[model samples]
Target: MAQRGGPAPFPDNPFQDPAAVQPRPGPELDAYNPFESSAPPYQVPSAAPPPLPAAGMPPPQAAAQPPRKASPTEPRNYGSYGTQVPGREKAARPPQGGPRRRREPQGLAFPPQASAAAATAELLKRQEELNRKAEELDRRERELQNAALGGTATRLNNWPPLPSFCPVKPCFYQDIPVEIPADFQKTVSTMYYLWMASTIALFLNFLSSLAWFCVEPSSGSGFGLSILWALLYTPCSFVCWYRPMYKAFRSDSSFNFFVFFFVFFAQNVMYVLQAIGIPNWGFSGWILSLIALRKNTAVAVMMILVSLCFTAVAVLGIIMLKRIHSLYRRTGASFQKAQEEFAAGVFSNQAVRTAAANAAAGAATNAFRAP
Candidate 1:
C-alpha cells in the first residue's frame, strides 16, 4: 500500500544496484486535500481499540470540539525548477575544510585546424624572407671578392715618405685601407692628412719667423728658435699622438686608445699655445703677428697667415679628438681594460722581467745581510 500509488519507481538495471534502490513514493503523499471547507485535518485512525467504560462508569462527555481551520486551495510557486515530490527533501550539506574534488570534463573536444590557404601563405612568407637573406649574402660575397682581388690587398705601406737609398729603413707599416676597418677608414685618412697639414703649418711658421727677422734684425732670436721648433716637432709629432691613434683604431686596443687620448690632449694644448704666439717663442703666433703690424705690412700679413694655419690645425685637432673618442667609446674599450693590457705587456717583456728580477735580488740581499 505504501509502495505503489504516488509515482513510478526507479527500475532494476545494470547501471544501478537493485538491492540499493530507494523506497517508492506511497499513496499517503498523494492524498493532500487543501480544498475542503469543513473537513477536519485527516488523521489515519489507529489500529488499537478505544478504551471501554468501567462498571457503570460512563466516559466523561467529550469536550466540545474546536472548529477546523480551512487552508487555501490554490498552490503558490517557489523558484524550484525540477520535478518536486511531497514528503521528500535532500539531506543537509557537509561542513567546510576539505580538499575540493577535481571535476572531470563530460566530453572531449578538438578545435578545427586552420585553412590550407593560411598555412600556404605563411610558408610563402618564410620563403621570401629566406630569398631576401640569400640575396644580401650574395652581395656581401661579391664585395669580399672585389676587395680581395683589386682593393686593399694590392696596396702597401709607404709612410715616413722615405726613399730606398736612405740608411734608415721605414719604421712602420701603415696602410689605412688595409689595416683599418671600413667604418674608420675615412676618419683615419682625415687624421693622416691633418698630420701632414700640421707639418706644413709648422714649416710655414718657421718661414714667417725668418721673414720677421728680415724686417727687424733685432728679432733674430725668434727665427733661430723657430728653426729648432720645426726640426724637433716635425718627427716628434708623428711619433707621439698620431701613431698611437693609428694603432688604437687599427687593432681596437684599449691601451693604445688611452695613450692617444693622453698625448693628443697635450698636443692640442700645445697647438693652442702656439696659436697665441707668446714673445720669444718659436711660433709666429697672434702676438708676434700683431706686433709686426706696426713694422711692415708684408711681414705682419705673412705672420698672421701662419697664425691662421696654426689656429686651423688647432680647431681640426679638437674635432678629430671628439671623433676618435666617439669611435673609442663604440669599440667598448674601458680604462680598466687598458690597465690590464699595460700590465700584461709590461710583464711579458723579457727586458722588463730581467730588470725586475735583478732589482728584487738586490733588495733581498740588502734586507738580510750578506749570506
Candidate 2:
C-alpha cells in the first residue's frame, strides 16, 4: 500500500493554505526597515535653505516669520485657490486695505448758481406776498374810514377816491336820517316819555307853589327864588329828556341812546325833588333863592307857578315825542333792510373775485415748482 500510495499525489501545495497564502515575514515587520518604504508618510517638505551668501560673505539672514497654520478643526479658506488649468497656479494676493472710495451721486443735478437763483426767487415771492398783504390792509382801513364818514349805511365802492352814497333808503326826512331799527326806536321813545313826564311833574309842582304864594303874600317868598328854581329845573330837564333824544337822533346807536337815557333819568328824579321844595334840594336854587326870598313873597310865588306850567308842557311834549319816535322806528327798519341789500349787491362779488384770484396765483406758483 505504501508503494502504491507512494506516488503520493504531488506534495500538497502549502500555497493553498489560508495562513501560508499571507505575505512572507521579512524586514517589513521590523521596527526599522530601510529597504521597505511606503509613500513616505505624507510629510510636507521643509523649506529650501536660504541661498548661500557670495563667496566670502556671511550667511543670508531669515525673513520675518509668516502667521502659523490654523488647526484642522478651524475654518479653511479656499478664497486664494485658483482653478486647475494646463500648467498655471497664480499666487494669491493679501487683502487690500485703507478707506474705500466713495461713489459720486447720479441723477438730476442743480448747479450752485441754480440753487442761488431759486433762493432769490423764493425771497422775491415772500416780499410780494408781504406787499400784497400790506396793500390789502391799507385798502381795508380806507374802506372802514370811508364807511364811518359816510355812515354805516354807505355802500362800499371797489374803486377808490369815488364818492359813495349811504346804502340805507331815505326815511321821513329827505336828508340822510339816523337809521335806527323799530325795536330801538320804541325804546328811545319810551325813554323820552319818561323824561318828559318827570319834567312836567316838576312844572306842576311850581304852579302849585304859585297858587300858594297868591293865597299868602306874606309867605316870605320872592321872584328871585322862583327864577332860581326855574333855572335849575331847565338844565336838569334838558339833561333828563332832550340830551338823550338828541343823541338818539344823531347816532342811532342803541347803546349810546340807552346810556344817555339812564343818566338823564337819574337827573330828572333830582329835579322832581327840587320842584317839591325839599330842603337843600338844588345847588343854585337853595343858595340863591334863600338870600332873595327875604324881601318879596308875591314875586317868588308867581315865578314858582310859571315853573309848574312849564312842567305841564313837558308832560305833553313827552306824549308827543313818544308818538313821533314810534313812527320813526317803523321807517328805520325799512332803511336797514335796504342798506343790507345794497351792501350785498355792491361788495360781495368783488370780495369773492379778489380771493379767487389770489388762490389761483398761489396754485400756479406751486405747480411751476412741482417735485
Candidate 3:
C-alpha cells in the first residue's frame, strides 16, 4: 500500500475501541477528506440553571431609575434658548401654598387713608424727620471738615492757592477780577471786539497789498513788507499797547497810563501815516494810485480803494480814541494819581539802577555836541 500524510482512519464509533472512547467527529467525519487535518472543533460548555429564590424574599431593584417629570413652576436647568443639558436636572420646586399678597417696591411707603388733618399731621411729621436727618448729616460734615482743618474753619494761616493753570504766585491774569471792576468788564469786552476788528482789518489790508502786487511787480516788496508788518503788529499791539491801556483803565496806575499813552500815540501816528500813503514806507497806496493812474486805470482804482479803506480805518480809530478818552475819565485816572503811581513805580522798578548809566551816556553825548 502507498504511504499517506494524515492520521490513519479509525472506526466511527468511539465505544467500539478503547482508544476511540475519547470524543470523535462521528458520522460527520465522512464529509471531510481523510487526508486533510484542521484545528479541533470548538466546544461550548453547558450553562448551569439559575437558583430559585427563598420563601418570602422579593427580587432586588435595578441601580438606574428613569428621570421624573418636573412641575410647571419648577426652575429648569436650561441651556441656550430652553435647551436642557444632559445629566443635569432642574432644582426642586418649593411646595405650593395659599395665594400670595402683592408686595410693593422697596423704599416706597404708602400712607393710610385717614382724615385730612391726620394726613397733614403725618406729612408734617415726615418732613420734620427728614429735616432732623439733614441737620444730623450737616453736623457730621462740619465735624469732619473741622477735624481735617485742625479746628479753625477760616483759612487764616494757609495762603490762598494759585490757580491750577498758573505755576507761579501773583499771576496778574488770575488777579484780573480784583484789578478790573465788574462795571469795566463790558468796556473790556468792547475793547476785545475792537482789537479783533483791527486784526481783521490788517488781514484785509494784506489782501489789498497782494492785489497791488498782482498789478505791479514793483509793489511786491511793499506787499511783502505789509505782510511782515501785519504778522508783527497784530500780536505786538494786542499784548503791549491794548493790554497796557486796559490795565490803565482797570486801575488808575500812572506807569501803566504813561505806557499806554506813549504806545497808543505812536500807533495813531502810524495809522495817520498809512492813511497819508507816504513814499517808500511800504504803505503808500494813495501815492502808488496817483502814479499808476497815468499808466493803468484798473491798478489805480484798486490802489485808491485800498487807500480809502486805510483812511476810513484811521478816522474810525480816532473816533474810538475820543470815546475811550471819555471812558478813561470814568476810570478815576487823574494827573495827581498818575504822578504818585509814577513815583512808586520808579522806586520799585528793577531798571532804576540802569537809568544812571543811560543818563551819564546822554550827558557825554550832549557835552560833545556842545563843543
TM-score leader: 1
Colliding residue pairs in candidate 1: none
In candidate 2, which residue ranges exceed 4 Å CA deviation? 1-179, 218-224, 239-241, 245-262, 271-371
- Local accuracy of candidate 1 as per-residue lDDT tens digits, 1-371: 33766654655474585555665667976776556555556678699977887888978677896754545663555635443575565664656786667786776543345466778889999999999999977755665575667664444446677899988776676867556789999998999888888899989988898888888898878889889988988888889878888888877889999988998898899899989998787889999888999999998999999999999999999999998898889889999999999999999999999999999999999989966
Candidate 1's error at 182, in angstroms?
1.0
Report backbone clashes per prediction.
Answer: 0, 8, 0
Q: Who wins the lDDT comparison?
A: 1
lDDT agreement with native, every candidate = 0.83, 0.53, 0.68
Residue 196's lDDT in candidate 1:
89
Between candidates 1 and 3, the one scoring higher on lDDT is 1
TM-score of 2: 0.26
C-alpha positional error of residue 365 in candidate 1 after TM-score superposition, expressed in Å: 6.3
RMSD of each: 27.8, 33.5, 28.7
Rank ordering of all candidates by lDDT, starting from the highest: 1, 3, 2
Candidate 3: lDDT of 20?
Answer: 53
Worst 10 residues of 3 by lDDT: 152-161
